[model samples]
Target: MKQREFLKKEKEDIRILMKFAGIYCRENHSGEKVPFAFKLFDIKKIERKEIALCSECTRLLTYGLTMRLKCPHDPKPMCKKCETQCYHSAYKAKIREVMKFSGMYLIKHGRVDMLYHYFK
Candidate 1:
């Protein structure tokens, strides 16, 4: 894929991950959360968005983004369909939990558009 395509996919993936993290953190965790600062991939636009997450969710999002950036697939396959697993087992499980919960929450709240990604 071209650099432009890769960056577009990267940005989309980042947005999805952040959305999932934000939803999970807000619903499942409590306490004072801070707005996360994203400093990777030169995504200044994303950095400006305020995504408040607990520390654990922040770490998970950071790890997820790092793993995503390091993925070797050119046209990156979905993690579940990828032959090469990039995430550590623990992180993978955590991410699955977040995705599952957030996906269902979105669907329940009328985000039918996410069904494809949720079921894929």
Candidate 2:
């Protein structure tokens, strides 16, 4: 994939994961709600949508985004299938929880189209 397309996919994946994390956070966290802008990689006008998430979710989202941006795979493989795992143990567990929970949430809610990345 070209750089542009890769970045676009990464941005969309981050947005999806963050949305899941936000849903999980809204149910669990009690801190103040905050806005997080997806403005990494100097893409300028792209991926600027702001998500309202708790501080802990925001940190997880940021960490996930950073890993996505720095990821070495082209036509990147899923994290589970990758040879190297970039996330710390705790973060890895947290992300798995978020992905699994949100994936089921989406599937149960009939958001089946959203499962392609999560399941495959």
Candidate 3:
């Protein structure tokens, strides 16, 4: 893929990852949330610059984003459909939990547009 397309994909994936982590953290965890410092790459274009997540959720989000950035696929396949399993088993399970909870919450809360991606 071209650089533009790759960057677009990165931004979208980052947004989704952050949103899922934020929702899951807020709903399931309790603690003082701190702003996550992005150390892998510059995310200036990502709108949510100050995502405050619990330590556990922040670690999960950081792992997810790292996997996304290092993905080997040219046109990245969704992790669910990909043949190569990049995430560790623990993180994979945690992300699945996050996706399930947040996806359902979004749909019930009138984020109808998320339905396609949720089912896709």
Candidate 4:
């Protein structure tokens, strides 16, 4: 699929999954729609920076049930451009935290096979 179409679907998927996983939404001070995609520190009200996944990774995550045990980064895990844009100066740490939380959550919830990719 084209990038725009892919992102549209992924965004919709994120909305639904986040809701299914029990997250709420709020409007930012500027009155823009913001989903609960970010953790506490990345909230729109607190930071103005909209946190998001790389389009590629978001696509991968949208199919959360089917990722393989291969690191998308391969030699070194690199952030997708969009994720880089979102975190700005703190991109590195934020991505790490996201990865860390994802791994732990999957493991805690008994998704052991999925955790393997994050380890790499």
Residue 64's C-alpha lDDT in candidate 4?
37
lDDT of 2 at 80: 83
lDDT of 2 by residue, 1-120 (tens): 224544667766766776787777776678798877555544324445556788788888878877877889888888888988888999999999988888788888898887776566
- TM-score ranking of the models: 3, 1, 2, 4
Error of 2 at 7 (Å): 3.1
What does candidate 1's lDDT look like per residue over 3-79, in tens digits? Answer: 22336677777778888898999999999899887665554465446689999999999899888877888888878
Cα error, residue 71 of model 3, in Å, equals 0.2
lDDT of 3 by residue, 1-120 (tens): 223333776777787788778888889989799987777565545844567899999899989988888899978887788999999999999999998999988988998685464355
For each of the candidates, give the backbone clash count. Answer: 0, 0, 0, 0
Q: Which parts of model 4 are misplaced by more than 4 Å?
A: 1-89
- Give the better candidate number (2 or 3) by lDDT: 3
**Candidate 3 TM-score over all chains jointly:** 0.86
Ranked by TM-score, the better of candidates 1 and 3 is 3
Error of 3 at 106 (Å): 0.3
Pairs clashing within candidate 1: none
lDDT of 3 at 42: 56
RMSD of 3: 3.1
The model with the greatest TM-score is 3
Instruction: Indicate whether candidate 3 or candidate 4 has the larger lDDT.
Output: 3
Best by lDDT: 1
